[model samples]
Target: MANHRAAWTDERAEQVIGELLRVGVILSVVVILIGAVFYFLHHPAARANYRTFHSEPDDLRSIARIAAGAVKLRPREFIQFGLLLLLFTPVARVAFSVFAFAAERDRTYVIVTLIVLGILISSIVGHI
Candidate 1:
């Protein structure tokens, strides 16, 4: 009975994790699409200035700027925010996995997950 219960718990955890990932990806795509729509609506005549390949403008560089721009319904910021969400999805997944492993009293897995989470977060902020 204990074995069966553990198996059931594991299966449920996997399902929940899978759902989390699917939802995250779908939400990211939706937000990005909405941003694209806003961009096209506001910049109907703007051409792709990809030849220069310059960095995004100051307003699109930082999260603070992006959030402020998003409040003003700026499409580039919306797209940038969406991209941020996309970037954080896997980090969120690892975060969830850490909690899930802790809940299961799986100390080894929990530690490993925490290490992975730490590395991921470090990578994100390492440059800063």
Candidate 2:
């Protein structure tokens, strides 16, 4: 583990985190764009009405169903998955912060980041 710790120098961790954010955002945009293109292709003249409000479909509410749909190349699911990825990107960064702090041997920051991570997770899963 000495070698692993050595590899996670502060600069290295920052660079990786920066790259991770960049890649995550770009991938999310690309996925959302692809999903949009497919959606428009399938529904050239589709329109939404502001006169009514509707909740998300039951099938699309859960992660398992979303993954299943996205895997099947469903356009809406792709869009949803992209949005999910976008939302998860920050959560992931916070999670990595715990490791980054631990690698730097900063116990206080590690604990703080863990608390933040826990809060993020609870907020995400709390409504369920």
lDDT of 2 by residue, 1-128 (tens): 65887677779889989998998999999999999998899888999776877888855677677778889889898888888889889999999889999988989999999999998898868333
What is the per-residue lDDT of model 1 for residues 7-71, given as tens digits with 9 covering 90 to 100? 53566788988998898899989989999999999999998668777786788877678878888
lDDT of 2: 0.86
Per-prediction RMSD in angstroms? 3.3, 2.3
**Residue 90 displacement in candidate 2 (angstroms):** 0.5
The positional error of residue 103 in candidate 2, measured at the CA in angstroms, is: 0.8
Against the hidden reference, what TM-scores do the models get? 0.85, 0.86
Report, for all candidates in order, the number of backbone clashes.
Answer: 0, 0
Among all windows of ten consecutive residues in candidate 1, which has the lowest summed lDDT? Answer: 1-10
